[model samples]
Target: MKSLLKALKRCAVAGAAALAVVSLQPVSSAQAAPAPVVGGTRAAQGEFPFMVRLSMGCGGALYTQQIVLTAAHCVGRTGANTSITATAGVVDLQSSSRIQVRSTYVYRAPGYNGDGKDWALIKLAQPINLPTLKIATTTQYNTGTFTVAGWGAASEGGSQQRYLLKATVPFVSDATCRSYSGYGGLIANEEICAGYTAGGVDTCQGDSGGPMFRRDSANQWIQVGIVSWGIGCARPNAPGVYTEVSTFASAIASAAAGL
Candidate 1:
C-alpha cells in the first residue's frame, strides 16, 4: 500500500499500527511553521467537549457515557486490550476538569485489516457526564465545510499539540481525493476526504481517530467521519482522509450493543 502520511512516519501511525509510519516529509532542512487542521487556530474551552485523547497516541470522541468512538488502529495490537484510557471533557489536556476512563471493550470491524474499515468503538469503564455527538445515518455530498479537532501535531514533523486545535476543512469529492498523487485507486466508499489543495489547514498525527463533524440542518453537530489517514499534513494536493461514519453506523450500533 502507498504510505499513509508525511512525517507520515512524521505524522503517521506508530504503536499498534502494524505498519510503522513512513516519513513522507520532503527532504528539507528548514523548520516547519505551526499550522492547524492545517491552518486552524486554538479552540476555546468546551468548544469541542466531545473530543477525547486516547492514551495510546490517537484522538477520539465521546460517543456515550460509556463509549468512545475512535480508530481501529489506535486500540493497541488488538481491541481486546485493557490498558487504554481516554481523557475527556476538556480542551486543554492538562485541565483539572478532565475525566479519565479505562477502556473495557474495543471493537474493530470484523474485516478490518488496515485500509478501509478504520473505525473502532471503545467502551469506557465509567461514564463522562457530558453531551455527546451523534453519528450521521446517511451519505451526503462531502463538498462543503466540515470541522475536525485533535491534540495532534500542528504541522508535519511537528510534535503533538498540548492543547486541542480545530480547523475548518472543505470537503473534497472522492474523485478529487483519488486524483492526488499516491491515492489514485485507494479511495473507498467507507472513506471521506476534506482539505484544501493549497496546503493550509488539515489534520496531522495524533489527530487520527478524532471526529470529522458538520452542523446539520437543525444546527446540531453530527459526526460524519473519523480521522484515519492522509498523504501529508496540510500539504498541497494531499487531503486528510477519514472513515465515513455513516457507512459504519449500522455496524457501530450492532457492535456497540454487545458492549
Candidate 2:
C-alpha cells in the first residue's frame, strides 16, 4: 500500500500539466506547481490571517484589504470575474468563522507564457478585515528559511487537507538548483527554489499560488515567493520552485494600485 501510494503521488505530480489544463485552464507549458504539505504541521486558527484557500484548489495571500497575491498560472488573464472565491480568517475549512470573498478582477503578469513570470494579483469584490501580507521588494529577504502554508495534500499524491498545513523549507541557491539534471538553465531570475535536497518537507499538489514567506528585520512576515512549480512532490534533487516575488515587486505594486 505504501508503494502504491508513492506511485500515485508521482503520477499526480507528473500529470500536473494535464490537471491544470482541465481544471485551472490557461496554464503554462511548463510543469504546473501546486502541492499540499508533505511533512508539515497543522496551523493554528490565527497563525496566518492573511493566508487564504482559493476555491480552485490553490492558495493565496492577501496583499491588501481587497487584493490578493498569487501565481499567474493559477488564474486567467486580466478581466472581470466573479467565480473565484477566497476563504480566510480561519485555518480549518469547516469552521464557521471563515470569511469568504469573491474575485472581482484578475491581473496576470504581462507576457506570462510560463517561461518566466509566474505571479498575479486578484482584486476582491469586497475588502476583508484581515491583516494584509507584505511583499519583499529587494533580495534582502529572499534567503534563509521560509514558511509555506496551504490546504494542499498532506502527502505526495494525497488528498487536500481540511485545515491549513505549513512547513519550513530552506532556500536553495540558483546555482545549486540549476545543477539539477532537468533544471539546467531553466531557473530564471524571476524564480526561486526551496526544499530539502534530501527529500522530506515540501509543498505538494493543491498548494499552488501560495506564499513562501518569512519574518523580516522588523519581525513581520513578508512574502518573498509564490509556489509555482517543481519536478515532483518531494523528491531528492527536485526542490519546489516559486515565483521570486521581489523580482516583480514594482510591477505588482503598480498593478495593485490600478486594481
Candidate 3:
C-alpha cells in the first residue's frame, strides 16, 4: 500500500502500476507511505506539546521527558544516532520558538519486520519540559473517535504540510477493516484501524509514528495507536492502520525504563 510515511519525505513519482503493487506492501522504511491528513484543520500553537517531528520526515510522541515513542519503520536499527533530531513545542515547522532535541540513541522494535510490531523509542540527549502523552494499557480507549495530527501530506500524492494538521476519525472494527478489498489479510489483531468508509480523513505519510489518541474520562489525552500504514491517503474502503499501543504497553514501559 502507499505508505502514510511517504507523506513525510518527498519521493520520485512512481508509475501507476508500481503504485498498485505497493498497495499491498507494509511500511518497511520511512520513505514510503501515503499523503498527509486530508480534510484536516490547522492546529493552534501549544496545542500538542508532546507531538514531535522527526528529521527523517516522521512524527512521534513524548513518552517521557527524555524518550519518544514512534513507529519502528521510521527509524533504523537500535543504536546511537546524533543525527536524528526531534522538533517539538510548536504547531508550525518554521516557528522560532520550537524546541529541537538530538537523539542520543534509538531502539527499534525487537522483531519489527513490517507485519505488525511497528513501535520504537528514541532517547533524547536531554529532557524537555513538555507534558508526555499517556499510553493506553487496555483496549478501553481503542474504540470511538480518535484525533490524529501530523505534518504529512494534505492529500493523496501531495506535498507535506508546514503547519501541524489534525482531524478526527471514527474507529473501524478489525472485521470491517479486513472486509475491505486489498486489506483482508493485512490487518493484524495487534493493529487498530480508523477512518471513514467513504475516505477523506486519515493519518498519512509523514504521520508515521505519530499518536492516534482520544480523551479519557479525565478529559486528558491518551494514545491508543501509532500511525503505521495504509493503501493510500484517506482512500475509500481503506482505513489508516496503526500499531495497537495497548498490545505493547508493558514492553514499551520496559524499553523506556532502560532508556
Candidate 4:
C-alpha cells in the first residue's frame, strides 16, 4: 500500500497539469444541467445537517457530537494554521445550524507521502444533537450501492451547489478501476472508487472530504468512504476515489475520544 501510494504521489506530481486538464472540462456551454437529486423522501433526513462545510476550503462529515471528519489536503500545502467551521442539521445553506470550530486534529499516516491518510477531525465548540454515523468494517465492494452528498459543483467547471446535493453511485472493483492507465494501480487498500466510468453521477470540485455512505440491513446509513480525489466529475474509466472510512476507524475513534 505504501509503495502504491508513493507511486500515486509521483504520478500526481508529474502529471498534475495533464490530469487537471482532462478532469476539469468546462460545462458552461451546455444548455441543460443534470437535475440534482431532490431532498426529502428517499433522501436521508437530518443527515446533511451533520454534514459540514469546512472553512478550510473543503467539505466534511460530522461523525460524532463534536467531531467533523474531512480531507487532510484541505489543510493546505504548507503546514500552516487554517480556520474551520461546522454546521449541524443544515437543509438549506441560508438557514441552517452553524457552529465555530474550537480545534482541529489532522492524522497523517506515518511516513505519509501525500493525499494518503487524507482525513482530519474538527472539534466543534458545542456538541451537535444529530444522529451519530457508523463506519463500515467489512471489505465488501461492488455488492451494494451508496450515496454521496455534498455542497460541490454540479459540473466539471461550474459553481458550487448553493444547497446540499447528493447522488447515488455503485461501487467499482479495485481490479476494474486498476485497469485504467492514470489511476489504475494507484487505488490503495485504504481507499475505494465509485461513480460511472463513462462520465456521470460523480463528485466534483469542492466535494472533497464529503461522506460516502451505504445502507445497512436495518436500512440505516453507514459511512464507507470520504470524498478524496478523482480525475474529474465523471469521466470514462475515471471513477471518483475516496478514503475508506473503515480503514481509519480506529484513528477516528481515538481522535473523537480525545475531544
Order the numbered candidates by TM-score, best leading. 1, 3, 2, 4
Quick one: best lDDT, which candidate? 3
- In candidate 2, how many Å is residue 191 off? 0.6
lDDT of 4 by residue, 34-83 (tens): 33411111224465455776654457777777677777655543222335
What is model 2's C-alpha RMSD? 8.7
C-alpha local distance difference test of each model: 0.71, 0.74, 0.75, 0.58
The candidate with the higher lDDT, 1 or 3, is 3
| Candidate 3 CA-lDDT value | 0.75
RMSD of 4: 7.9
lDDT of 2 by residue, 1-259 (tens): 2223222232222111111101112112233333433637778779989998788777889999899998877788889988999899998888998899999999999998765688888899999999999999999887866888888776666777888877776677777777875666454678877766665667777787888888889999999888777765777777777888999999999999998
Cα RMSD, each candidate: 6.5, 8.7, 7.6, 7.9
Report residue 192 deviation for candidate 3 (angstroms).
0.4
Report how far residue 12 has shifted in candidate 2, in Å. Answer: 11
Candidate 4: minimum summed lDDT over ten consecutive residues — where? Answer: 13-22
**lDDT, ranked from best to worst:** 3, 2, 1, 4
| Model 2 backbone overlap count | 8
Q: Which parts of model 4 are misplaced by more than 4 Å?
A: 1-47, 76-82, 96-110, 140-142
Report how far residue 167 has shifted in candidate 4, in Å: 0.3
